[model samples]
Target: MINHPLECWLNLRMDRPLNSGSVSPEELQAWQFGLLRKTISHAVKSSPFYSKQLQGVVPDEILSPADLNKLPVTTPEDLRKNPNSFLCVSQDEVARAITLSSSGSSGTPKRLFFTSGDLERTTEFFQYGMGPLVGEGETVLALLPDSRPGGVGNLFAESISRLGAKTVYPEDPSDIPTILNLLLNSRASCLLGPAIHIHALARLWKSKRLPKNQVRSALLCWDLLPPVAIETISNTFGCEIFSHWGMTETCLGGAVECFQGSGMHLREPDFYLEIADPETGLPVPDGTSGEILFTTLSRRAMPLIRYKTGDLGQIISGPCTCGLSMRRLGDVKGRLDTDILLPTSEYLSMAELNEIILQYVGVLDFKVNYQQQSLALNIALDIAPESKIPTDLSRALTSYPKLSRTVLENNLKINIIIDNNDGSISSGFGKRLITSS
Candidate 1:
C-alpha cells in the first residue's frame, strides 16, 4: 500500500528520505519540544505580548510537551485587543496580515501576521496534503478567493502547480452558475471550496440533469461539512468526498483527511496540538472530547503558544488503518459559543440546523434568527418551490432530537420563510452563525 502523503512529507521535512518509513511519534514529539523551547525564547525576547505574558518564565524549563500546560493559553480576545504586540518580527519583515472579524456583536477583529517563510510552510503543506487527491496534469477547480497575493487560495493554487497540476478559478467564487460552467469546461478532476457552495452547485447540477463526468474528488474546507451536504454532493456528483479543518490563525491549512477516511492527520512538524477541557483549560485524555488548542512549532513572524481554537474535537488513539502512527483529530463539532440553550433545557446549534435544513432538495442556503424563544429561518431554494415548502421544512425540523423536546414542551414557534426567486443566499465562505435580534 502507498504511504499517506502527509507522512511522507513529514519525513522529508525532518530531512529523512521519502518511502523509507514512517516517522515515529516519539521522534516527532522530541523535535517539537526542541522547537517549542526555541520558539519560547524567540517570542519572549521579541514579541511584546509574549514578553509580558511569559515574564519570569524560563524557556529551558519547557523540556517536553507536558511543560506546555504550565504556560498561559492565548485567546482570540488577546489577539483582538493588541495584535501588534504579538508580532515578533519587524513590520518590514511581515509578508501578509489577515484580519478576522469577531462573530459576536463585538466589532473588534483579530489580526494575524505572517512572514514570507511562514507562508512557504503552509504552501509546502498544501502541496503534500493534496497529493492523494490530485497529481501531475490534472486540473483542480479552486472555488476560493485568489485576489490577494498571499491568500489561502493563492497558496493552494501555487501548491497545485508545485505538484505539476493545473488550477482554474471561477470569475466570481460566489456565483454558482459560473463555477459549474468552469468545472465542466475545465474538465477539472477535483473541487476545493466551502461545503454550502458546493452543495448549491450539486443541487443546480442535479436540477439541470448534467452528467458528473470530470469531477473525481472534492475537497471541502473553510466551513462545516454537514452530513446532508456530503450525502447530496456524493450522490449527485459520484465523486469522493474529502474534508479539511483549519482557520485563519492556522494559516488556513491545518489537517487534511487521508484516503482511509478514519480522521484528519495533524501537521505535526509545524504544530503541537492539545485537547483541553474547555471549562478548566486542562488537557484531556486521548479519545476524550475537548477544546482544540495548538502551539506553533515552526512559526517565525508570530509564534502562538497554547492558542485556543474555540472548536471541540478529540484525538483518535492508536495507529491509523493506513499504518501510520501520527495523531489524528476526530470529528470536530461547532464552536463552543455557537450552541444556544432553550427554556426546555435543550441545545441548538447552526450545525444541527444545517444538517436538518440542507437535506431538502430545493434548499440552497438559509439564515437563522433565534430570539426571545422564537426561531425564524430564511431559506433559499434553487428554484421556485411549491406552497408546501415552508410547511415541509418546519415539520422536518421539529422532528430533530435536539429541537423536538424544546418544541413540544415550550410550544416553540418556528417560522420558515422560503425564497426561490432570489440569487444565492450566502457568500459560500466563512463560518455560519445564528443571529439573535
Candidate 2:
C-alpha cells in the first residue's frame, strides 16, 4: 500500500531515511509521549499559568500517554481570564496576537498569541494537508478573508504557493455573484471555503444553468461539513469533496482527510489528541464519542496543556487502507455549548437539524429559534417562496426520533417563516446555532 501523503510529509519532517519505510503507530505514540513530557517541562518552567496550575506535578513522572490524566484540563474561561499568563515567550518574541470573540453569551473574548515560528509550522502543515486536494500548478480559489497579515486564509495562500499551486480569492467573499463569476472566469481547479457558502454557490450554479466540472475538487473547512452539502456540491460541480477539522487554537491546520476518506488523520507530531468523557473528564475507549482534548507538542509562544476543545469527537478504530498509522479523529458532532436543551431535558444538536433540513430542495439556509414550547424556523430559500416548502420543512423537523418524542410529550408548537431574501441573510461565517427570539 502507498503511504498517505501526510505520513510522507511526517517522514520528511522527521528526516527518516526513505529506505526505512513508514513509521508505525507505536513509534508515533512513543515520539508523541516523549515530546509531551518535554513540552510540559517547558510550559511549567515558562508559562505563569502552567507553573502555578501544575505546581506539584513533575513532568518527568509522566512517562506514558495515560499519565496525562494526572494533569488538570485547560478551559476557554482560563484563556479568556488572562491570555498573557499562558504566554511562554516574551512580548517581543510574539509575531501575531488574534482576539477571537466567544461564540456563546460570554461577552469576553480569548486571545491567542503565536510566534513567527509557530505560524511557519502551521503554514507547513497547511502545505502538506493540501496534498489530497490539489496538484502542482492547479489554482485554488479561496472564498475566505485574506486581508490580515497572518490570518488563516493568508496562511493557506502561503501554503498553496509553497505546494507549487496558485491561489486566488474573491474581491468580497460575502458576495455570492462575485464568487460565482470568479469561479467561471478563473476556472480554478479547487474551491476552499465554509460548507454553506460552497453549497449556496452550487445551488446558484445549478439555477443559472452554468457549465459543470469547472472545479475539480473542494476543501471545506472552518465549519462542520454536512453530508447534504457534500452531495449537493459533488452533484452540481462534479468535484470531489474533502473536509478538514481545525480551529483557531490549532492554528487552523490540525487534521485532514486523504483520498480514502476513512477519517481525518491527526497532526500527531504537533498535537497529541485525546477523547475524554465530557462529564467525568476521563479518557474514553477508542470509538467512544466524547469531548475532544489535545496537548500541544511543538508550541513555543503559548502551549495549551490538556486543553478542552468543547467539541465532541472520537478516535477512529481499525486500520485504514491509506497505510498511515497515525490516529484519526471522527467527524466532530457538535459543540457542547451549542446543544439546545428541550423541556423534557432532551437535547437537540444543530448538526442533527442541519442534516435533515439542508437536504430539502430550495432550502438555502435557516435560523432556529425555540421559546415557550414553540419552535420557529426562519428559513431562507434560493427560489421564490413555495406554498408547500414551509409545511414540508415543518414535517422534516418533527421526523427526528428524539425531537418527535419531545414535541408530542411537551406540546411543542412548530412555526416556519420563509424569508423572502436570497439566502444571504444567514450567510455569516460563524458557527450556526439555535437562538431564542
Candidate 3:
C-alpha cells in the first residue's frame, strides 16, 4: 500500500513543470519588477502606513529601480508605532490572527495579522522548497514544537501535511528522550527542526547510545546551522542535511536545498530577494554582502514591499547545478547590527567568528566580546578545558593581526569563561549560542 496522503500537496502546489527550477536571471528581474510595482501599489492603496507615507506620491507611476528607493524603507519601528494603521484590508476578510515577536533590537513585542490566504501561501512555499526533498507518503519527524499564530513549527506542520507526510511533533525542545523514542518506534523517514535541537539530540545520542539510522533526510531550519552541528549530523545520523533560511515574519519556507546538497534555492516567485548596502539602501552586485530585503506578493492583509529583513546575505550569480532557478543567498551573516567592535579598529560578527571556532565537541555555549580591542571568549563546555584548545588557539587568536598586536602589547586582554548553561536550551525567544549582554 502506498501512502497517498500527499496528493493534497499536488493540488495545492503549482501545476507547471517546476522540475526545471531555473528562470533566466533577466526573466526573473522582469517578473520581479512587475511584482514590485503591483506590491507597492497594493501597499500604498490599502495600508494606512504606506498611504500616509506615499501622500502626494503615486505608487503606480513609480517605475524603474531608482524610483523604488523614493518609497522609503519601512522599519519594525514603523509597524510597532502603529499596527492597526498598517492594515491593508478590513477585519472581516482576515481569516487568521498571527502574532510575531518584535523585530526590535531590545524589549517589547509586536503582533501582526494574516488572512487565511496569507497562511495558505506560506504552506504553498513548502511545495517548492521542500517538495523536492520530501515525496508522497514519507514520514517526517518534526523536532519543532507545534504552535500557530506564526512560527516555524506551525508552518512546518502545515507544509508537511500538504506534502502528505505524518508529523510527529515534539512538545518542546528539552524533551529529548521522549522525542528520540518516538523517532525510533514511529518509522519517521525524514527529520526537520531547529539545528540546536538536533545538535542537542546528537549529544544525547552519544551520551545515552541509540540507534542512528531510520532517517533518510534532515532539514536544518529557523536558526543558523553551526558547522559543528552539520558534521556531527552527517557523521552520527548519516542523513543528508539541507540548510533552511527564513524568518517567521516572512513565513517559514523562503528557501531550501535539494538532495544535491547544493546551496539554498530561494523561493523567488513568492518573494523578491535583495541585498543592498544598509546605509545607502542601494542594491549591491551579486557576491557582495549587504542587508536582505523581502517583498511579499500574495499577502493582502499586511503587504510589505522592499521590507528590510534585518538579515545580511548576497546572491549567488553563478548557476546552481541543482536545476533550481530561484536565486541563492550566501551562507547568511547574521543581523546587520549584530556586530562586535574590536579595539583594534576592526568590527567582528560574533556569529561569523564562532562559525569557525565552534568545531570541537563540548563547546556547548560561547559568547565573544570584542570591545575596545579586547577579544574575550565566554565558553560553556561539556568537556575539554582551555588547555585542550591547542597552544595554536592563543597564537591563532593572535593571528587576527590587528586585534592580536593590541593584546600582546598589553593594550587588551582576552577572557575565556567556561560556564555550563546546565544543558538548558531555547528556541526563537531566548538567548543561546552567540548573544550580546
Best candidate per TM-score, number?
A: 1
Which lDDT tens digits does candidate 3 get at residues 113-170? 7787887777777754666567778778776533633553577667777777767766
lDDT by residue for model 2 (69-162), tens: 8899999999999999999999999988888887678879999999989888888888878877778888998866443556756888898988
For the record, the alpha-carbon RMSD of candidate 3 to the native fold, in angstroms, is: 4.7
The full ranking of all candidates by lDDT, starting with the best, is 1, 2, 3
| Tens-digit lDDT string for candidate 1 (77-99) | 89999999999999999988888
lDDT against the true structure, per candidate, is 0.81, 0.79, 0.64
For candidate 1, list the clashing residue pairs, or say none: none
TM-score of each: 0.94, 0.93, 0.82
The clash count for each model shown is 0, 0, 5
After superposing candidate 2 on the true structure, give the runs of residues whose Cα lies further than 4 Å from its correct spot: 1-3, 145-147, 373-391, 398-409, 423-425
What does candidate 1 score on TM?
0.94
Error of 3 at 212 (Å): 4.3
Q: Distance from true position, residue 368, model 3, in Å?
A: 5.6
> Which of the predicted structures, 2 or 3, would earn the higher lDDT when compared with the native?
2
Q: Against the true structure, whose lDDT is highest?
A: 1
